[model samples]
Target: MSLFLTLKVALRALIRNKVRSILTMLGIIIGIAAVIAVVAVGQGATVMIQEQISSMGDNILMIFPGSASSGGLHFGAGTRSTLTPQDAEAIMNECLYVKAVSPMVRAGGQVIYQDKNWSTSVNGVSPSYLEVRNWELKEGAFFTDSEVKAASKVCVIGATVAKELFDTESPVEKTIRIRNMPFKIIGVLVKKGSAAFGQDQDDTIIAPWSSVSRFLQRGSFNSVNQLLVSATSIKTIELAKTDITSILRQRHKLSEGTDDDFSIIDTAEITKAITATATTMTMLLAIIASISLLVGGIGIMNIMLVSVTERTREIGLRMAVGARSKDILLQFLVEAMVLAGIGGVFGIIIGGSTAEIVARYNDWPVLVSAQSTVIAFLFSAAVGIFFGFFPAWRASRLNPIEALRYE
Candidate 1:
């Protein structure tokens, strides 16, 4: 028999038991849908993480005070205030690969405007802080070097703070009290959603380091909490780190074999760590989802076996009428493929819709690629062939006399 006639016969056979055929394809449909949806969600999460990491800064490095040891016990990083504003200036002036540097002093207090009060972090930094952090002003300008030197009570509010305090009104030129001291709002930072660690990026306030040290917190004027360093380019980040470390060691006068009093955090390293974690999670989820496909293949094999047993006498009739065994095998194989192929097509449609619905409901990112869809369809077809072969071969090899004589 020709391929077309075989397919028509196989299709007719399936149509005769419509409910059974549909039930048999249910497993394939569910399996393919699940795999596609899981993959799409995983890919979306990975992309979202990468974007968050990139938004932190371009070729940035953070320098923090190293841990201090006392009584054989060691404190964590940032426990000491060994970093200073002078160190930041020296890095910009001496480090050839360094593009910009900012000294940071951190404090926390309630910000009061009119009758509303919101507690938030108050960071003391110079004008270069914005440049190093790749932050932009939404309403006003940053404080100048002279203002930082004079310990002026001028500040920049982030989007979250502005919204909390002023609502729809602009916060520039407004007076807000931090730590019971009034500060004139000089600028408002553009909105930055959130950090990679889930911290709210737009929930703090920025001011001169001198002001924060003098009025907001009781600390030495020369001491700073951290330094934000921007490299000339991504290619120069490592070189910049090396140069900064050497310069700081010399400035701090640390001898050989002595532990330095500072720690450097490269944005590239953070990005790599985050990407690695996301990739691992995606693969894990994909692997778990794949098990459903295997289960579905087993379902196909079981159903095909029942189909062969039910149609034993029909097979005997065909073989007795000169129909070749290979023809019988081909017809059954094509029927299985047709079932799987149709299920796959429907599964893709359902999966894409499911992914979109999930993304919308959860406000998450989802990407459905053409490549994944094609792979899923091809895999389904392969599963059908592998699982259906045994039952098909059994049907072809049946003894015609015994089949005809059976009740």
Candidate 2:
């Protein structure tokens, strides 16, 4: 028989038992839908993470006052005020690869705007903090270098802090209190959303390093908690780090044999770690979803076996009327494929809708690519072929006389 004729015959056979055909396709529908949904969610999460990383200047490097250890023990770069504002200034002035640097000093306090007060982290930083972190101004200008140098009482508020303290009102040129010291609100930062590390980057306020130094001056003016630096390029991060370390060692008067108390972190390293974690999660989720497809495939095999038994006499009659074993096999396989293919098509629709709904409510980035949908549908078809083979082969090899004579 021609291919079209065989397909028409298969369609008629499936339609004759509408309920059974629908029941057989259920496993395939569930399997495809689950797989597609899981993978789509995973892809969306990965994209969101990458976007967050990219937003905070890909070439940025963070200099903290501690050393990273592998054995979960704290030893190096510990118990010292190792990093200082002088080191940050030295890097900016001396390092060729360094583009911008900011020394950050954090203090937790209640930020008061009128009667409405919010507890938040106040970041003492220079004017270059905005540039190093790639922050954008929403309302007004950032504090000037003179303001940072003169210990002027001015600040830039983050979006989250702005909303909590000022609501929808303009915060520019207004005064807010940090630890009861009034500082003029110079600007509001643009919304940064959540980073891959789950840190709300836009939740803190920025004040001049001089203002913080004077107000909370138990230590030296040159000393700071951490330094945030941005390199000219990602490729130049190693050069920038090496140059900064040399400059700091010379400035801090450290000997060749003495271990440096400062540690530098490349943002690219953090990005790599986050990407590796996300890739692993996506693979694990995809693998788990594949188990559902395997179960569905087994269901198809079982149902096809039962279907062959029910249609044994019909098969016998067709064989007796000059139908070849290959034709018999092809007919059964086509029926299984048709079932799975239709299920896969609907599954794609449902999966896409599910992912969109989740993203809409949660405000997460969701990507539903054409490649993913096509792959899912083809996987379903492959499952049908693999699982339908045994039943098709069994139906093809049946003895025509015995099949016809069976009760």
Question: By lDDT, who's the top model here?
Answer: 1
Candidate 2 C-alpha lDDT tens digits along 200-307: 878898899878877854566777878899999989999999998889889878899987768888878887888788889888887887888888888888888988
Clash pairs detected, candidate 2 = none
Residue-wise C-alpha lDDT for candidate 1, range 287-373, written one tens digit per residue: 787788788888888888888888888888988998788988887888888778777888788888898888778666778889999
The CA-based lDDT of model 1 is what?
0.88
Write down the worst ten-residue block by lDDT for model 1. 45-54
What are the lDDT figures for the candidates, one per model?
0.88, 0.85
Candidate 2, poorest ten consecutive residues by summed lDDT: 71-80
- Give one clash count per candidate, in the order shown: 0, 0
Instruction: For model 2, state the Cα shift of residue 310 in Å.
Output: 3.7
RMSD of 2: 3.7
Quote the positional error of residue 299 for candidate 1 in Å: 1.4
